[model samples]
Target: MPSVMEMKPLATFFVSHGSPRTLVDETPTTEFYKKIGEYARREGIQGIVWMAAHWETPYDTIEVSSNPNPDKDFVAFVPDEILDWYRSYKINSSPALADRCCGMLKDAGFNASLNSTAIWHQDVMIPLRWMYPDSSTCPPMSLISVNGRFDPYFHLKVGQTLRSLRKEKILLIGTGGGIHNLYTLSWHHIIYYKDTTPRTKPIENFAAAFRESMNESVVRNEGGPGLGRAMCRLLKHPHFLKCNPTPEHFLPMVYAAGGCTSYEDEGSVNAFGGENWEMNTQLNSNFVFGLPKDDTIFLGEGS
Candidate 1:
C-alpha cells in the first residue's frame, strides 16, 4: 500500500529577492519573477510557503506567521522614499493557511509554531507583489523564519516536511540573495542601486564562480544518489566562503532545494544586477526545481 505522501504532486522553487528596488527596477530578475507569476497562474498555485533573509529566530524551531496582517518590517528610513515606497503597498496574509502549515510541520516532528508575531518583510513583499501584482489574486501566503544554526540540512528537512502540501497546489518559494556578502555592500549609494546606467559594481570573483558551480551541481547533476554527493562536493569546494560571507541568505536556497524528490529539472536561471559594491559577482541567480505544465512560453495567465 502506498503512503499518503506518495500520492501528492508538487514542485518547489528558489527565487532571489535581491535589493528592495527589485520591484521598481527593470531587470532580468524581476522579469524572471513575472515569468514565474505566469506559471503560477496557469498551475493555479493555491498559496505560498515562503521565507525571507530578513527574518530569523534564535530558537531552533520553525515558525509560521499566523497573522493576516504582517508588520511592514525593515527599519532603515534613511531614504524616506524607500521607506514610503515599502509602506505604500497594502500586504495581506492568511492566518488560517499559516496555522495549517504549522500543523503540518509539527506533525512531521519538526519544532514548528503558528506565530501571530510574524512580520512581512519586503523580501516577501517585493518579489511576490511583483509576480502577482493584484494582491487579491495572489495566493494565501505564510512566512517562515530561519533557525539559529542556518543549517542547510535542517532547512532542507523543513522544506521536505511540507512536501505534502505541494499536491494541494501550494507553492513553496524560498526568497533570499544567491550570494550575500554584506561586508562589501555599497552602502554609500545604497538608495540608488539601479542608477548605474552603464557600469555595474564588482563582486568577488570567487562569489560568481561558486554560484555557477552550485548551479551546475543542483541543475545538471544526475541520479538520486548524486544529489547528496553533489552537495557534499560543493560545500567543501573552495568557493564556499566567497559565495556566502554569512550563511543566512544562502540557507533559503537550501530550503528551496529540499523540495525536489530527485533529479528535478531547473528552469532558466536569470542572473542580474551588479550595481552594488559587491559588483557584478554579487549576482542574485534563481532556480525552479519542477517543470512547468507543458513548458509553455509567453507571458500572463491563461484563459
Candidate 2:
C-alpha cells in the first residue's frame, strides 16, 4: 500500500451547514451534503479536520477538540424532541490526528491547545449526520475551533498550517453559511413552509454583491497565502455586515479558502452545486479546492 503522504491529494471543502434541523430536512443543501459524502467515500478519505462556526475560542489561542467521542452541544430555540434526537448522533474522533493538529499549529506560532472535553455543536454535527450518516463507519474526525475574535486572516493562517493534511487524504471542512443573518430570517416562512424543494432563485442587492465577491476571490488562481489574503479583504466589504451580522459564520469560509492556498491551478478552487437560500437569510454555496485535474466530472456535481 502507498504511504499516507504518498497518496493522491484530496480537496478541501467549504460547506454551508444550514440549521440544526437540516439533519432531518430534505432540502437542496442536504442533497449536496449527500453528494459530497459520496465524493469523499469515492476519494477514499481516511480522516477529517472539521472547522466549525459553532466552535469558536478566544483570539489568543486555538483549541483542538481531542475527545474520543465528543458530546453534542444542543442548539437553543428548537423543540425538546429535536434536541433529544440530535443527542443520539455521535462521532468517533482521532486522537492521534488531534494531537498532530495541535503540534502543527504550535509549530506555526499559533497558541494551540488540546480540548479533551469539548462539546460538538450543530455546525459540526448537522452536516456530518447528513453526509456521513453512519457514524460507526464514518471517518475518524476531530474539530478545530475558530478564533472567537473572528479575525479572518488569523483563521486563514490556521488553515495554511494544516494544508499538508490534504495529501494524507484527510478532508478539511469549514462549515458556515455564506449569508447568515438570523435576525432577518423568515421565521414564519420556515415554520409554515413544508416543501423540500431547494431555493435556487438568485439573491438580490447586498446578498448578491457579497456572494459574488466571495466566489471571485476563491476562484482566483493564486497561492494559499494570496487566496487567504483576498478572502480576508471581504471583512471590509460594504455588504459584509449585512450578510454576516456576526463574524463566526463567515470566518470558517476564510479558513476553507486558506486551505486552498496549496493549489495554484486556475481550477484548483471549484464551487459545489446546489446553491440554496434558506429563509432568505442563509446562502449555502459550498466549495471544494485542490481537486485533481482528472476529476473534473466531480465538479459538475455541485457548482
Candidate 3:
C-alpha cells in the first residue's frame, strides 16, 4: 500500500451500480466505473469507505461492518455464471477503520455499532469489482449502512460526520440509482421485448426530468453544508416519488454529498457519468465531489 503523502487527494463519489449485469455489460455507466478504477490506481487511493442503498439498518441505528472477511450477499437476479464469476475473487476489509467510523458516528450523537458478521452485498461488491477488477489490488474497504428511516437529512449529517476521512486519502463512495422505479421499469421492459428487444428501456419524460433535476442539483451546488441542503430538497422534487418510490436508493446520494464538503469551502463537484438510462427508469448518474476545478482527469469533453 502507498503512503498517504505519496498519493493524490481523492474526492467523494456517488456511482450508480445499475444492476449486477453491470459486471458483464459494456455500457456507458460501466465505462465510467472503469475510469474511476483507473483514477484510483493512478492516484494511489489508500482505502474506501462505502455507503450503499441495499444495506439499511432498522430504526435510527446505523451499522458498520467490522468483519475482516465478509461473505457475499446479492439482491438482483444474477445468473449462475455471473454469480460464479463474482465469487471467483476475494474482497478485503479493514476492521480497525470500521471501528473508527462507528466511533465517529457515535460521537456525533448517533446510535452506531459494529457487526463482525456483516456480509458484502452486491451494492457494495459490484462497483468495487468494476473499479478494481483485481481484488488483491483493491483498497481495503469499510462498509457502512444507511438508516432504515431513510431521512435524507440524517444521512447527509452522517456523511458530514465522516468528511474528514477524505484528508486521510480514503475515497468515500455511495452506490445507488439516480432513478429507480422497478414497477415502471418492469412494464417498460415488457413493452420493449414485444417490439425489437433492446437491452435498455426507452427513456421516459418523467425519468429524464428527474435525472436532470438531480444532475443540476449536484453540479450547481458546492460541497458541504450547501450541497447537503440542496440534496435534502430532492425529496420534494415533483418526480421524486415516481423516480424513487422508496428512499433507500436515493438516500445514498445525500450521504455522498455530505462528505463532499471541505473545511476551506473549496470543494468542487463533477458529474462524471450518466449518459445512459437503464431500465428506462434509471439514469445511471454518477458524481465526484471535492476535486480541484483544474483537475481534468475525471472530466469528459463536455463535463
lDDT (10s digit) by residue, model 1, range 248-291: 77777767666654443233221122212223445576766544
Q: What is the lDDT of candidate 1?
A: 0.65
In candidate 3, what residue range of length 10 has the lowest lDDT sum? 188-197
TM-score of each: 0.82, 0.88, 0.89
For residues 67-121, what per-residue lDDT tens digits would candidate 3 score against the true structure? Answer: 9988887544555776776887687799988989999999999989999998888
RMSD of candidates 1 onward, in order:
4.9, 3.0, 3.3
Alpha-carbon local distance difference test for all models: 0.65, 0.77, 0.77
Shift in Å, residue 106, candidate 2: 0.6
lDDT for predicted candidate 2 compared with the true structure: 0.77
Best by TM-score: 3
Give lDDT: candidate 1, residue 265: 28
For model 1, the superposed segments whose C-alpha errors exceed 4 Å read 1-8, 75-85, 148-150, 191-203, 222-225, 228-233, 262-281, 292-294, 297-303
